[model samples]
Target: MRRHLDRIDQLILAELRHNARIPVAALGDRVNLSRNAVRQRIERLERDEYIQGYTIVEHTAEARANVTANLFVYRTDRMRGGEVIAALKSVPEVVICDVMSGEFDLFVRLEAPSVDRVRAVWQQISMMTGVRDITTTVTLSTVIDRT
Candidate 1:
């Protein structure tokens, strides 16, 4: 079962989403709660898994979302789908591999740490036994991403 969150709890979550390092007193001021009450609620939020953890979002030019690419793969033998997918499972950069219904046999999404790594992932996919042809497109700029 899931726990229910009240309006104040929702407000607390919103503030934390913006700045996870906000102090207890500062958060309390925004949420209209005393310091101790805020601390207790935060503890409860953590214990209940509503507040799982925090992460740093690096804004540096090189630190943006690594490199994302899409690969359209053609296969020589359509019967070898399972073997190709199983091989891709071992490659960490292979984020999404879906069997498609057109000229291409598979549509793949890759997220690598660098452009070179993205090319390497594409090469790896190409070398698979059943793969016949491949077309790759790298993301130049992400206009909007909700994921």
Candidate 2:
């Protein structure tokens, strides 16, 4: 029988999405699974095509030349608004999302091939149910990036 994804499985996928090169043992620790168990689940996910492959984010000047923006997301129900986060996961361009303490609830960073695409993504986020408001700012240039 084909296996269905559980919350643990989803967590594993989320961790992998953030850092594709994360060690299986470390990933297991984050998801509260054993190393072997995590390995097996990863293999199953790959075999089942849930995980096709892993790739690195380019940091070259040419790559950085693409459109990048920050989205200050204000949530209506901050404590109960997990739906907004789940929705953000569906957007491939959203590279980073930080849950914050005051004012805005989420700080989202997105990168796209063009300004139009970034605008479209911004529009999409603004329309999600729990999202109260979104203030967007496009990056002019990267002065320093350690990573």
Candidate 3:
């Protein structure tokens, strides 16, 4: 069963999302709760699997200047394309590859140093067995990234 979150829970989640390492007392100050109350709520949230994990986002100049692209991939055999996925995993530029439904079998997101590098990675993916077709789209800008 799914759990329904109230306003306080939502606010706590928002603050934690912005900074997972935020102190319980600071979080309580923001949410109008006591420190122990906030700690208990956080523990419950984790126990309920609402707070799965935390991670850091890179803000380096090299990371910001990288070329980003999305690839809509059509596989010859969607059910048995583990080899293709493994090959993609070997490519350092491949950031995310998600299995999809509907017309596309896979959606791949990659970041590389330059457009030339993007092209090279694209060619490498296109030549992989079981990859029937790939449609690549380069990102011009990211206007609103809450993450």
Candidate 4:
């Protein structure tokens, strides 16, 4: 399906991406539209699920000290698919999960407070039932995090 977004909609999205709490009046001023028009557009976007919801991104001190680890997991068996997914979800350190192909069955992105914590997470994953092998790469720096 092709969803067409006008210039005003694009402006609204761009503004929201920068600051979701910006007032509709300010947004209207920025986009050169009436406040009512901006409000209507925002409502439509929300109703159509284009704009899901507003959220805040907190930068905690602990997070500043943390290191991110990306893990590529190859599973030995497909029979325990649900179990594997459930286990992944149970690990709070696993911040992102995706089912992948090629040499790996799953890819996971995790954050730990320190290198020791990353090592502990790797050990925990190594002990999982059907995980055949795990390859981990530590990110030296993050140039972009669209999320």
Best by lDDT: 2
Local accuracy of candidate 2 as per-residue lDDT tens digits, 41-84? 99999998899877676868788777999999999999999999
In model 1, which regions exceed 4 Å deviation?
1-7, 39-60
- Badly placed stretches (over 4 Å) of model 2 are 1-61
State residue 1's C-alpha deviation in candidate 1, in Å: 8.9
lDDT of 1: 0.87
Q: Write the per-residue lDDT of candidate 1 for residues 94-143, one digit (tens) a residue.
A: 88999988788899899889999998888888999778899999999889
| Model 4, residue pairs in steric clash | none
Cα RMSD of predicted structure 2: 13.1
> Between candidates 1 and 3, which one is better according to lDDT?
3
Best candidate, TM-score: 1
TM-score of each: 0.71, 0.60, 0.63, 0.67
lDDT of 2: 0.94
Assess candidate 3 and give its lDDT: 0.92
Query: Where is model 4 more than 4 Å wrong at Cα?
Result: 1-18, 25-38, 44-52, 59-64, 78-83
lDDT of 3 by residue, 1-147 (tens): 447888999999999878888988999999999999999988888878898766778878877999999999999998998888999999999999999999999999999999999999999999999999999999999998786
TM-score, cand. 3 vs. native = 0.63
Provide C-alpha RMSD values for all models, in order: 3.3, 13.1, 4.2, 3.6
